[model samples]
Structures are given as C-alpha cells and as structure tokens.
Target: MKIFYPLIFSIFLFCYEISGQYYPSQEWERKSASSLNMSQPLLDSAINIASQNENAVNRDLRIAIIEAFSREPYFEILGETKERGGPAGLIIKDGYIVGEWGDIKHVDMTFSVAKSYLSTVAGLALDKKLIHNIDDKVYEYVWDGTFDGSHNKKITWDHLLTQSSDWSGQQFGLYDWADRSPREGEIDDWRARKLYEPGTHYKYNDVRVNVLAYSLLQVWRKPLPQVLKEKIMDPIGASTTWRWLGYHNSYVNVDGIKVQSVSGGGHFGGGIFINTLDHARFGLLFLRNGKWVEKQLISKDWVKSVQKSSKAKSDYGYLWWNNSQGSWEGVSKEVYYAAGFGGNYIIIDEANDLVIVSRWIDNSKIDDVVRLVQNSIK
Candidate 1:
C-alpha cells in the first residue's frame, strides 16, 4: 500500500511537469491576443484577400525575405488576413485595425521598429518635462566625460533621431551586432571616439541608440522599458509580455543593476526575438497618432515630428525614414516608414490612411521588396 501511494504521487508529479511544459494557460493565451482589435469590415476584406490572392507569398517566401539580409535564421510574417501560416498583423486604415492574420493571439519582436516607438516615447517625455529638448546634450543626464573634449558632445537627440550623428558608423555593421557580441570595453572605446563633428554628417550606428537608451534611463530615473510601459505600452493596451533589448545583453537597468532587456530592444538590437501579431499592435499605435482606444498614449505633435524627414540626404527623421524617391509610378511622395534589416517594416501613408507592417527573413534584394510594397499599395 505504501509503495502504491508513492508511485501514484510520482506519476502525478511527472504528469504535472509535462502539462506545464506544453500547456499555455488561458491568461497567457489572452495576453498573446491582447493587441488584436480589428474592425469587422476590414477584417472581412483582409480575410477575403488573403484567401483569394494566389500570388501572395507563403511562409517560405517570407522567411527567405528576411534570411537574405539578417543573421538570424528564423522569422515570422504576420499579415492582416486569415490564411495558412499567418501571424496577426493589424491592418489599420484611418486609425483602426480592420484585419488580422496568423495567430492574432501571439506576440512578436518588432526589432528596429522599436526605434520609432522609442522616439515617440522620447517626444512624450519631452512634452511632460521628463526630457528637455532634442538639442540637449545626452551627457547632461549620463555624464561619461567622453563627449567633453570632443565634437561629439554636440551630438543631440535630434541628431540621433535623424541618423545624422556624423559618427561614420555603418548601418550594416550595426545590424551585424546580432551575431557578434562585442565586449563592453570595446563598445565604450567606440563611444568615446567621434567619427565626425556632431550634427555635421550622417551615420548609422546601433551604439548611438544604446547611448540614447542609457540617456533615457539617466533622465527618467527609471529603466527605459519601464518608462515605455507606463507611458506608452499600458495606455495603448500593449501586452505586458513584450520586451526590448539593450546593450550588455540586459533588458532593464537600475543604476548599476541589470535586468533582461525588453524583447523589443533586444530584437531591434538583434539580441531578442518576438512574434508577428505584437508588431501589428505597435503599428496600430503609431497609425492612431499615439491614441489607443480611449487613452492618449503619445502626443500627436511628437508623431508628426518623428515622421517628417530631416534635412539629410537619406530623408531620415528620429529613426524614421521618409520618402526619398520623390515620385514612383505616379504615387504621391508623402510616404514615411520605419524599416529594419531582415525585411521588417512599418510603412505609414497618412494621405492614404494606411499602415503596412511585415516581418521576413533577411534579403539581399531589399529594393525588390520595397518596390513590391509600393506596387501593392498602388
């Protein structure tokens, strides 16, 4: 009798462990779908299109798109339609999600898409007096003494946003950091050096973004993730499961203490991972001018400022990329976008009231992808 009881107890424990490993609770399932809120008409159209579009690429093609450009081997493509291998991609027209694809119940990484989101957060911080101005030297908050004697001190939030920091950092090199984990000292050494006079030229560097993240921490007296959550994520009803990646492989930092960087930060920095549906929710937030449902998450002025292009050759703005082609195929030149390596994109056409988001594997022919997106809209 004693042996029988012990055996039964052991069996119960094993069963519980196995169930826990495979079964996501109802709460988790709900959290995964938290970002999915589409209007009926739009959802219906998306579903119809998804079902009928024979040329629509499959998951394999989507993965190929990202693998061509990114070091990461895996990817997910969410769309605003109900179809095979779909992840939830919220299609917003005039500020409401009308359709979704894939598992609307899953959250994904947004990668550099987080940059634009962070920029909006910074704008809100400024409006609330949490941050002063774009021209304010970042060293004012996090004084590392490196910018003191160099022209780099002139580098401001404005410069970083516009990708005009003039630091001579290569965009592809920054994108490659996902595979190469450099030491802290190496990163610090690079930070200390000025590639060009601040605000005098344009360069793309992920390290500059890290500095931005660190500056936010210094000024807010809270981690960047927390600031984002309270100021933007919660208001937008964003899922609590999301995260952002940061330097040193940490998510959130308090003074000297380090925590896991949020998935958004890590994915954008090439350290974290996520699902496709969450990406769409993020897009919806921007499409709605920072208003999510009943709350004003970010100021509209901030959104306009970040979306507009700076006086740079690349037509960049606060990490957002503006239309540089002037006109393509009679299409109006009023498009702005937030793009990432491995074919992640959030393109907003305010004039047309459209927001398009896609996640794919890295691809060498990014121009082809861009052209395809443009053609689709036309």
Candidate 2:
C-alpha cells in the first residue's frame, strides 16, 4: 500500500515537470501594477522602499573592500574592483517586470551572488554527468595536488556548495583560515587549529569557494565563464555586457591552454559584474524550477536540491540562502534567495510567482521589502 502511493505521487510529479509557461526574451515585457492585480500604491511603496535604503558601502568599491575585509591580515583587492553606482533592482511577478527602480541596465559588481551562478554550473555538470554525484569525493575527479592532503580529500561537491567543506589550503594567494576567521584569533592559532570534518562545519570562506571554482575548472577542462555562457546566460537571452572574472593570478593551464578560473564572490575583487535585468532572468529560471517555457534548462531535481537545508547551516543551501531557519523572521520558509555582499540579492518567492532582485540597498530592510512586495499582490 505504501509503495503504491509513492508510485502515484512520482507519476504526478513527472507530469508537472513537463508543463510549459510564459517566459521573457531579450526585451522583457512590462505590465502595469494594476494589470497584475497588485495594489498600485502598495507596489510603488515597495519600489520606493528598495530604491531609498541604499547600502552604506563606498562608491569606490576598492575602498569598500578594504574597509570591509581590513581586519584580515594583508588583505588587498586581487580581482577587479570598480566604482559602483546607486541602488537598482527589479520585481518580476509571473515573469514580467511589474516593478523596477534605478538603472536596470547599469553594470555593477554583484559580490557573492556569483556563488549562486557557480552553483548552477555545478548543477549543469550533474545533469550532463560531468559529475556522477554530489556525494562523490572531489579528489576522485581533481587528482591534482589541490585535494592531495588527507583533510581536503574528504571534501565533496556537497560540502563545497554549502560552504561547509572546511577545505584548508591556499588558493590565489589567499588562505582558507585567514578568510572570515574568528575576530579573536591570532595568525598562528588559526594556522594550527584542528580541521573540522568536511561537511560537519560551515564557514563563509572565499578561498575555499574559489577552490570550488578551480575544481570545477578541472572537471570541465574549460573556462567557467564559457561554460556559463553556453549552458546558462545565452540560453536565457542575457546580455553580453556581463562578465565573470577571477584574480590576476587565478589563470592556469587546462590541457596546455591557459584559461582563467572565476571567483565565487567579489571578496578580494573579481566576481560577477552584471546588470539588473540579467539578474531577473537568472532568478526567474530558478523560480520556475529550472524550467524555461517548454525547455527544462536544468534538472528539476537540481533546483529542488539547492533549496534544501544542509546539516551544518539550516538557512543555507547549495549557495542559495533559505528562510527555513527563520533567520529572516516573518518571511516564509519557502522563500529562498541568492545573496551577496553589499545587499545584492536574487530572492525567489515561489509561492507568489515572484523574482525580486535588490542591489545596494540596506541589507536589514530586505525582509520588509519582501513582505511589502508580497502584500502588494491583490
């Protein structure tokens, strides 16, 4: 009897996956607030909320990076850092731009939001069997000395995606321990500290995140940006203005051809420099459960996997942030997002059929932004 029910549910899910939907193309169609059955005033107020509360980071992003990560020993911007502009964002209700503010076309650094895109690359790898399973040890594919150590060899794709890898070692002149280390620790204390069993601890370390990028590069044997372009960005009809960059020293020879490895975030500098509309497109892809119109861009299973809470961090998934842990009180646990430094976000509210991208806004006000937008729906 139990097996019969399980089979019936599986058939229902399979049918749902093949369903089609309306999606945006190169020029996204916009609808009036009233057309979408949303409160005009309330929607305007929500847009104002995001446009007004700007992030406090310096306009000269070089200074901003220094001030933010200054505590780390000898921290410097190793990747590209450029001057940033004012707040910008978009609100997509049912795949249409229902609300927007600031320069939607302006190109700017999106910090750690790149991690979500990197996570998508991993999903594609899994879909195409470039990676057999997320549970497989990374050392099996990346036999290079990078994962040679006893501790690192224990790491898996799962651990890296969740930032729980606790992967030790240096990548591109940055040490894993030195990144976001404890405020009270001395250098030697961090260096000599006992390792956490891979996947047992969660730490937001850019060095380790970069290690994931480097490992993916090894598996793909091509530049990640090219992979992203072919597999994701282009298919979704994103603009050519965006770029995924890494450190000056991050380039390595892949099969005798020198290719650059991209960074997961804009921590020490280079990450995703993207505009708002492209972000909206990326968010929409996930909001639809990886289904774009009739084409399933990525597997439905991968989309679901990115939202599940991992053991180490209940509010974090494979590079996507979750509300399940109630970290953002009053927000629905079903709402998951891709967040980056300086208030960059690609928030997905599947319940509302919405994709909200808020950049350079006060990070604290994000929940209010979400709640207000949700309230605007009639």
Candidate 3:
C-alpha cells in the first residue's frame, strides 16, 4: 500500500509539471513574444491597433454614458452607469502575458460581459447542489411571483442562461419590456407582444438576467458577489478591487436577510466594475476548464456546458459568444468569448491555451485584433 501511494504521488507530480503551472497568484508571469513562437513586431502592431481603435462607440466616456441612456428600451435598459473608462487590453498565451496596452488597471463597466460571470455563478450553484439541475424549472426553486405565470413557470435555468426564457415580469424596478425592446414597435405594443415558450426564442433582456441573479441570491441565501469571491475569485487569486454592482432597488429578502441581486451588464449602469488583469484571470479560469492550480473551482462539465451553443442561438452559449460560423478563419471553431458593449471581451481559446482580455476597444475591431493575434503565431 505504501509503494502504491508513492507511485501515485510521483505520477501526479509528473502530470502537473508537464501540464504547466496554473497562475494561482495575484501576479501573472510575463513571457517574451519570441519565446512563445510569436512575432514581436506583429504583436506590437496588434497592441497599437487596439490602442488606436479604443472603442467605436465614443472616445468620450460621458457621451457614451448619455448615449447608453438614450438607447434605453431600445438598445438597453435604463440602469446605473459610471462615466469612467478608457481603452485597455491584455494578451495571454500559455498563461503568460505576451503583450499589453493602455491602462491595464482601470476599473471599467464591462457591460454584457457581466452575464458570463453571472452564468458562472449559476454553474457554482449547480456544482454545490444549491440547485439540482439546469433543466429544473426556476419556479420550483423561486416561489416568487417572478415565475408565477404559466409561461414564466415553463422557464428553466437553461432557458435563462441561454437568454431564451422570454420571462415576463418586472425585476429590480425594471420592466421586462423596458430592456432592449424592439426599436420599431410602440412601447405598449412591444409590452403586449406575443410571448414565446421558454427556450424557443432568443432575446437579450437584462430584466430576465436580473431575475436569474435574484433567484440565485434566494438559493444562495447570500450576496452573489460573496459567493463568487468565496467560491471562485479568492481561490483563483483575483484581486479585491473588482466589484459586482446592482441597482439600488435590486435588493430582495432572502432567508430573513436582505441580499442585493447584481446586474448582468452596465446597461442600467450596475454590472461588474473590474480591471483588465482581473478580467484576464477570470478568462484564464475558463480557459483552464475552471481549474486554478490544484482546485477545480468550477466543474469541468459545467465549463463545457457553458460553451455549448444553444439551440435557439447558434453563436451564443450560456451567455458566452461562440464562433459557430468560424468567422475568424484560422482560429478554431471551438473558440468562444465573453463579449460586452464598447468592445470589452474575455476571449478564451482553449485550442491555444490562451485568454485575451480587451477593454473598451472598438467593438467592430474585435475580429481584427483576434486575427492579428492568430497571425503572430508562427
């Protein structure tokens, strides 16, 4: 028995060594572009391009904030927003930063990218058995009026994660129809529009996402941020500067204590406000299949499930963007990313063991940046 134990320990060490060290520390190691078989000049070019094309939205963040308000019920929800942010990006190859540009430490509103984190919290809840199955109706766990209706009761956790729930109701003082409603329709018409069965149609609605967050809070019986920090971030060595914010009205009673349900985007202004390096660490977590060093912070099966394309949306998987069309040419079709408004992205390329975090870049230029990175590889 003693001999068998020693042999197993040696094999474990061998596997760990060959697989490379996971960066389970606040500081990320840096590697030269040439060391990773990448062209340093091309990498520099990629960084420069990203810096120049900060964001297609607006160079002035205040103007962007005003525009965000104008898009309410048309392109987004009317929630809280901060008028602070600038261009920043980081490139990680084999868990090391090869190149970076702009203010890598600036905390900015990550827009819809918060949805990915929200989805991950769902995964954690599932992993801990707080919820039995993704297929189970959310109404079963959340006995609130949020899922009281027939259509809403049909909404499952999978439906919410996939943005196909068509969940009807107001949450956190935001009406369902007031979140990214069709621009062509009148407010009342859009509000009274036909409801689709859960998981049958796709709609990027923050109200529904907030509903998911609130439900998760009920199940967790604590703040979602606390759950994330305790279960994932701290274990992965993420910094404390990061914060998940929700609207002032987003509080709800859970287990006799008031818990605030966080937003999934900055659409209304309250979402994840974090730095570029923290975003990179989160991306690396997913890239490594939810493992941080020796601990599987999130289950491997959950990670795989989040990347699987939804039936309702080919290019979307549990809030993450999938490259179903293989639009990047040389990049693997398995490549998926967490994208947000104003070009914030945490791209995970499991094929290359890479995680790229780009903040406040031109949303339209994401593909170009990605392509540039791919071309740098020899």
Residue-level lDDT for 191 in candidate 2 = 79
- Where does candidate 2 stray beyond 4 Å? 1-20
Tens-place lDDT digits, model 2, residues 1-378: 787998997765564334444577666878998988999888888889899999999999999999999888757789998899799999999888999999999999999999999999999999999999999999999987899889999999999999999998888888888898767557788779999999998898899989999999999999999999998888888999999999999999999999999999999999999999999999999998987766788999999999999989999999989999777767777999999989999999999899999999999989988988888888
Taking the tens digit of each residue's C-alpha lDDT, what string does model 3 give over 218-293?
A: 8888999999999888887788899998978777777788777899887777899889998998998898888877
Q: Give all candidates' CA lDDT scores.
A: 0.53, 0.90, 0.84
Q: What is the TM-score of each predicted model, taking all chains together?
A: 0.64, 0.93, 0.91
Clashes of each: 37, 0, 4
Which one is best on TM-score? Answer: 2
Find the number of clashing residue pairs for candidate 3: 4
- Model 3 misses residue 151 by how many Å? 0.8
Deviating ranges (above 4 Å) for candidate 3: 1-18, 58-63, 69-80
User: Please, what are the lDDT tens digits per residue for candidate 1 over residues 121-213?
Assistant: 578778888768778876566565524545556777787666666533222224222323345456545445546666666655555665565
